[model samples]
Target: MKLLLTSGGITNDSIHAALEDLLGMPVGEADALVVPTAQWGHPMCGPASVRGLVAATPSFRHFTALPWASLGVLELTALPTVGKDRWVPWVEAADVLLVDGGDATYLAHWLRESGLAALLPELHGTVWVGMSAGSMALTPRIGQDFVEWAGAPDDRTLGVVDFSIFPHLGAFPGNSLEHAERWAADLDNPAYALDEQSALTVVDGVVDVVSEGEWHLLRS
Candidate 1:
């Protein structure tokens, strides 16, 4: 599996280069299925937000949002049983899957509920790109600080990656490097704290950190 997990989407030259390397082609030639399902519980989660995100990463040949929320089922098991003709084909056709930031729990719930988690393994060359909450949801578990911050009911995640990510390190309002460090210090599993200009790239089972700003890894 190939993944570009970021605090913010392709925000700088280094990150852009990393993405290009992963794609093995200019981003303009690639198509993406943007999953903004994580933004469901936020007030700013709307068409404009999605548009702005797409605009920032102008390389995609096409960027479209998957309407997972429209289905309305709360349980993860309901997704595979229901037919998702509107988005499934688009997901299959895209070269990348772009996930935006919001509440990690909310995002994970929909990803599993929409059957995207199961379908991911079948997407051989499709790059999984995640930003902020999108990045966090792919971890084995959500860190305590994040669960408390979001008031999320559970810390469970998709477990697509072994380590947990703490995004927007020293970049988010009210968050600082100290706060991230404290959180990482308490985690039993491997953890990473990433700023806006940093990303965690994972290929097969190897992990690499690409950054233009600040980042750190914590392991015990």
Candidate 2:
């Protein structure tokens, strides 16, 4: 699997170049499916938000928003059966699956319940790009602070990645480098703190950090 995890979306030349390299083609030629389900119920989850996100990275000529929130109420057991007709085709067709940030727990719930988690491994050529909460949802567990902030019950996550991600470091009301350092100190698993200009790239299973901003890795 190929993943680009960011605190913010593509914000610099290096990140853009990395994405281009991952695509193995011009960004304009790629087809992207933007999943803004994490932003669901928020005022920013509408068409305007989609437009703004797409504008920030104008490389993809074809962009489609797949609001997964519509299926949020369905039973988790029903997801695999229902998703075949509704989401499978879209996921299979896209070259990129761009997940937007909002509430990580909310996103994780839908991803699991809607069967996206089960299908992700089958997306052979697709690039998974995540911003903020979207990035955090892919990890084994989220920080306790973030779980509390999101008003969620637990820090458990999708576990797509073995470690945890502390995003928006040094630039937010949510987190700072100092805070991340404190959090990492207590964690048994590897943790990464990333600022807006930085990203964590995973190709197959190797991890690489790319940044124009600040980032840190904590392992104990």
What TM-score does each of the candidates earn? 0.81, 0.81
Q: After superposition, which runs of candidate 2 have C-alpha atoms over 4 Å from their true positions? A: 41-82, 148-151
Distance from true position, residue 102, model 2, in Å? 0.7
lDDT of 2 by residue, 1-220 (tens): 5898988877888988888788776666777766776765244366676555545434322122222121111222345676578767767777777777766777788787788888889887888888888798899787777663344567788999888999988787648777898888767789999988999899988899999988888763
Writing each residue's lDDT as its tens digit, candidate 1 over 18-132 gives 8889978777677765666676645556667655555543432222322212111122334467577755676677777777777787788778777788888887787888888
Q: Quote model 1's TM-score.
A: 0.81
Pick by lDDT: which candidate is best?
2
All models: lDDT?
0.73, 0.73
